[model samples]
Target: MKNIPFISALFTPALIIIILSGCSRIYYAPTTQNVPLLTEQNELRIAAGISGGEEYEAVNIEVAYSPVKYVGIMLNSFHAAENSDSLFTNPVRYKGNLTEAGIGFYYPLATYYTAEVYAGYGKGTAQYPWSFDTIAPLKFDRFFVQFSAGMKRKYFEIALSDRFSYVHYTNIEEMYKIEAFSNYKYVPKNNQLYIFQEPALTMRAGLEAIKFQMQYQICIPFSGPTLGYSSYNFNLGIMLTPSVFFK
Candidate 1:
């Protein structure tokens, strides 16, 4: 599936802003959640939610179906916007979308505890922020592995998850014009491989059909050629899930 454009597109402009603002960060870890809804035979689920922060925002939708007792197939899509600027420049905004599909397995570890694992891949496109004339030629391919454990109570549930991701950006030279970074001495040296890890804690409350969700996440970059990249990204979001499962 295809969709993850806005977050990818924001890279160039965000890089410029960060560099000009006296920092040298070139990577961002998109906000993602891991909530496994394992259904009974022939059951399906549909969920949507909105999430945001000072520099980025997103709308997400997901569909899942369980053909067996503990395994599920899932599909998801997102539209996101990212904005930033140097202290002296007006803010520049970038918008794009992404979609992914994956499979997950869940099992109970204890009376109130469960564990889950899932993986997915997706692609997206966005226009270069300099102008909308040409679509960004950057080729982005992403792969992720996630693990989660949670406890469920009568009306509330708490979950903790870790997501490991690898992303490769191809044909990066297309946007590597020297003029673009003339104002800054340091520029991204490698565009081929980026690695990130995110750990999140989530809580949900309410009945089966309607529930409220909130999450806090921290993103850590493991590998990159960089100077002063944000080691800890403070992130947060909220969501509401309706009709979690259809029997």
Candidate 2:
């Protein structure tokens, strides 16, 4: 739990994908507003991501587009939480890969809502006892698809997100499978199990020279219901983004 503060330092704030076109008016059509849609006209960008706070660490890969009206994809590799016979049982060094492919569309003058759809695929493994035993590790497969409607504003957008995930392995790859509360995702590498191992939320904010995409959020089970953490998955990293902020 001490890592919470360390992760807090990295937790700069909400990620803002600010559309700096600087239109004086708040309500205007994208055609007139000169919006930064993910169309062919956008500058293509590559991105990398790092995540995990007192729980798990994850790496993400994505392609950022400014030219397209609203369309892009994100690929991710989520590491399972490490097991813990001790405070940290060599923390489960598990990896699951996922890909998100979707589109953003709207009416000629509509704002604050866009049609969205996406699909994903992932796989990972761990020892029967959440250890890297020489014996064959247990494996799991996952995939999900959702037809969602997303809100769109210059500052932020909150959407009603609904997603369903599946986990497989007869011997139970995740400890959760062995626990009382049954979660959709495997136990990850950590013995700790919680529902919505990876909950889904959608929001984005912009910083001085960077933009953030709030892909999903998790209420830190360790903390009170109020004191929870969110996961900002699958977005651009500062090191690789182009310097279009000032221009």
Candidate 3:
């Protein structure tokens, strides 16, 4: 009976330490991958939506146009942010944005199927709470190649896409000081490189000109440094093809 009290006393501190150490900070959040099913010239696709998972949310905008036969161009932007309730004594917050542009070729595989390939470059900045009183900002560059194929019907569409990306972190400020927090040990170091394979499934349903869209995506680490990042993403939004309405 006397030993019971001694065991509890020793275990209490260890349990607290474990709980505190388990808290992790997110350094990377994957954005929604845009998939536009273009089949011919003069086709345009515009989409705006909200995407999020686990610890963050984002506003996403995408535009794709086919100006010439089998030639397509696209632009995408994402603004993401997260603010968590206080952990221990301090709150954690993050703000970031990314922009990307790509050019690609698309072709119709069958009556309703289309296939496309694109390569793009992206740049982004992330600002997050590094310490109880300090926030650190980081910049990163990414290059990606994506392949997509889908079926488009009169009132519905479905697509599957896989994107491979290489990300490099730069302009890291105060990375050396991150070691002060034990929980943040998983954060990536300066000049780190990481390769990610992201695959997504997208669906849309509604009228011929406008439709409700949803996407589910997963991010997998392919190589290089690994850290705490959002691995899954869900997006809900609307897609518009103005040309269809006019036709």
Q: Estimate each model's TM-score.
A: 0.73, 0.46, 0.86
Specify the poorest-scoring 10-residue window by lDDT in model 1: 227-236
How accurate locally is residue 199 in candidate 3, as Cα lDDT from 0 to 100? 96
Task: List runs of model 3 lying over 4 Å from the truth.
Answer: 1-22, 87-92, 131-133, 178-181
| Model 1 lDDT tens row, 1-247 | 2556877786977875656445232324364564654434455655567766445567777676666878877787766665456442223345556677788788878788878888888775433343334333445667888888898764788889888777665555555552146423333245546778888887777776555677667777767654222333332333333334432
Candidate 2 global TM-score: 0.46
Task: Count clashing residue pairs per candidate.
Answer: 6, 20, 0
Per-residue C-alpha lDDT of model 2 across residues 125-225, encoded as one tens digit per residue: 44433234533245545454444555655455445444444333333334443322322222333332222233445455564234565444432232112
Best-first order by lDDT: 3, 1, 2
Per lDDT, the best of the predicted structures is: 3
* TM-score between model 3 and native: 0.86
What local distance difference test score does each model get? 0.60, 0.37, 0.84
lDDT of model 2, residue 190: 31
Candidate 1: which stretches are off by over 4 Å?
A: 1-27, 37-39, 85-92, 131-137, 182-191, 227-247
RMSD to the hidden true structure, all candidates = 10.2, 16.4, 4.4
Better of 1 and 3 by lDDT: 3
Question: Any residue pairs clashing in model 1, and if so which?
Answer: 3-97, 3-98, 4-97, 4-98, 5-97, 6-96
TM-score: model 1 vs. ground truth: 0.73
Which runs in model 2 stand beyond 4 Å of their true positions? 1-48, 53-55, 64-74, 83-88, 91-109, 127-136, 153-160, 170-199, 207-209, 215-247
